[model samples]
Target: MDALLFMIFAAIAVICGINLVVQTHPISSALSLVGVMGALAALYLLLGGEFIAAAQLVVYAGAIMVLFVFVIMLLNAGTEKKLAIRPWGKYLGAPLLLLFFGMMAYVVQRILPESSPVVFGAFQGGTAAEIGRSLFTVYLLPFEVTSVLILIAILGAIVLARKEVD
Candidate 1:
């Protein structure tokens, strides 16, 4: 059951990732990214990383994707212009991508233990309290730096908008 569920979500994640890369429109790509993130959250849940799953849903799928959509809209980013690809690129891209994917799958299968099952209650210690404690104690500086970087991004967006108005 666990393996089946993992396979389903993993397939969803892979499809969404491919969609994200292949989509021409920014909005479409962003939506595909959200799907990828949601699938990853489910995978994390199956792995018993509850806090990490919640964080993935709330932070990446929710807030970060919202921010991305906002930026895309604010900048009026339209569908990407179609550019002519080289003949070899057009002919070989899909085959090369599939070959790379096959190689990666083979490597991952070789690296991971076959008998290790992801049971729901098999792992622990990913609670919000523990995460908060670790973030505040050990990762405080990095967290603060991230906040400052976000502030800068927001400010930069505002400045750009103001310039466009002027």
Candidate 2:
């Protein structure tokens, strides 16, 4: 089951990455990126990281993707031939893509250190109660600060979309 889930996530990640390169439309690329993020969240859930999964979904898929789509729509970009790449872009694109993949492989190989997973006994209740308690108690200040930052981001988005008054 874990292997199947991992395979599915790997496939989605590849598709999202290819779309990032080949999709000329900004909105489509943004949506594809969100798909990648959602796949990552699912993977986190499969690894018993429910809190991280929920955070990924809420912060990336819900809030960030909505902001991206909103900005794309606001720009009123069209899918015209003008969106096509220049002649030189075609000549340089394949090599650039190859270089990017090679660099990514090198970075992954170099930076990812091996670590054994820690096994622990199951709790009496579950993670939700523990996470909630910590969020309101030990991590209360940082959590409240994050909420404030999110609020500011929401207000900034609204102001950016509004028409300016003389």
Candidate 3:
């Protein structure tokens, strides 16, 4: 049952990701992204990451997607215009991507031959409190740096939006 559920959600995530890339309209792309996020949340649940799953659903699928849709609508984004592809991209893209994937697969297989199967309860992504503890303790510097970067970005936006006096 767990394997079946994993397969289902994994397929859903892959399909939604393809849909997201293929959709031409901004709204349609955003909806496809939401579907992808939902599938990822289900995958996290299957991996026994209840907190991460809930966070994925609430923070990504709910809040971020809502913000994306709102911005798209406010901007009245239209269907994406077809762009001309570079010559090399058109001719060599598929073969290069395939080669990269094959190389990565070979390297990973060589490095982790004894990797175990992902079974439920095999790994816990920790509870909210434990995550919070690590976020503030072990990862404090990176967290503070990210907050400062966000503050700088906000300040930059405010400065850019200010009107100049005549």
Candidate 4:
């Protein structure tokens, strides 16, 4: 059951990634990225990383993607102009992608354990309570700093994007 869910989510992520790259419109690409993030969150859930999956969905898929769409809309980005495909890219692209994918599979299979530690329900520390405790105790400063940095970045984006009333 877990394996089947993993495959389904993984396939969704790959398809969304491809769609993100191939889309001409900025909004369409951003939507594809949201799909990718959702698939990744599902995969994280299947791996028993409940907190991580929630964070991925809430942080990446929700907040960050909303920010991206806002930026795209603020900039009024339009559909991308299509360029001529190069012969080499047209001819060798699929072959090269397949070769690299095969190599990655071989290396990952060799490096990883037969029974992966991150399998569903194998990890014990992925609950929200444990992560919250750790964040408050050991990682509090960095977490706070990251939050502040994000706030500043958001402010900077807003300031930069505002139109001057000339």
Question: lDDT of all the models against the reference?
Answer: 0.91, 0.80, 0.89, 0.90
Model 4 lDDT tens row, 2-120: 77888898899999999999999999999999999999999887777899999999999999999899989999999988888899999999899999999999998888848644467
Per-residue accuracy of model 1 over 1-166 as CA lDDT, tens digit each: 8989999999999999989989999999999999999999999988878899998999999998999999899999998889899999999998999999899999988899486666877877777887889999999999999999999999997898688563
What's each prediction's TM-score? 0.76, 0.65, 0.84, 0.79
Deviation in Å, model 2, residue 65 alpha carbon: 1.8
Local accuracy of candidate 2 as per-residue lDDT tens digits, 1-166: 5677788998998899789767878888888998899899887776667777888999989988898898789988756365676888999988998999899999987887675532222223335777889889999999999999989998997887696857
Positional deviation of 103 in candidate 3, in angstroms?
Answer: 2.4
Clashes of each: 0, 0, 0, 0
Against the true structure, candidate 3 reaches a TM-score of 0.84
Judged by whole-model lDDT over C-alpha atoms, candidate 3 comes out at: 0.89
lDDT of 4: 0.90
Model 1 spans > 4 angstroms off: 71-81, 113-115, 164-166
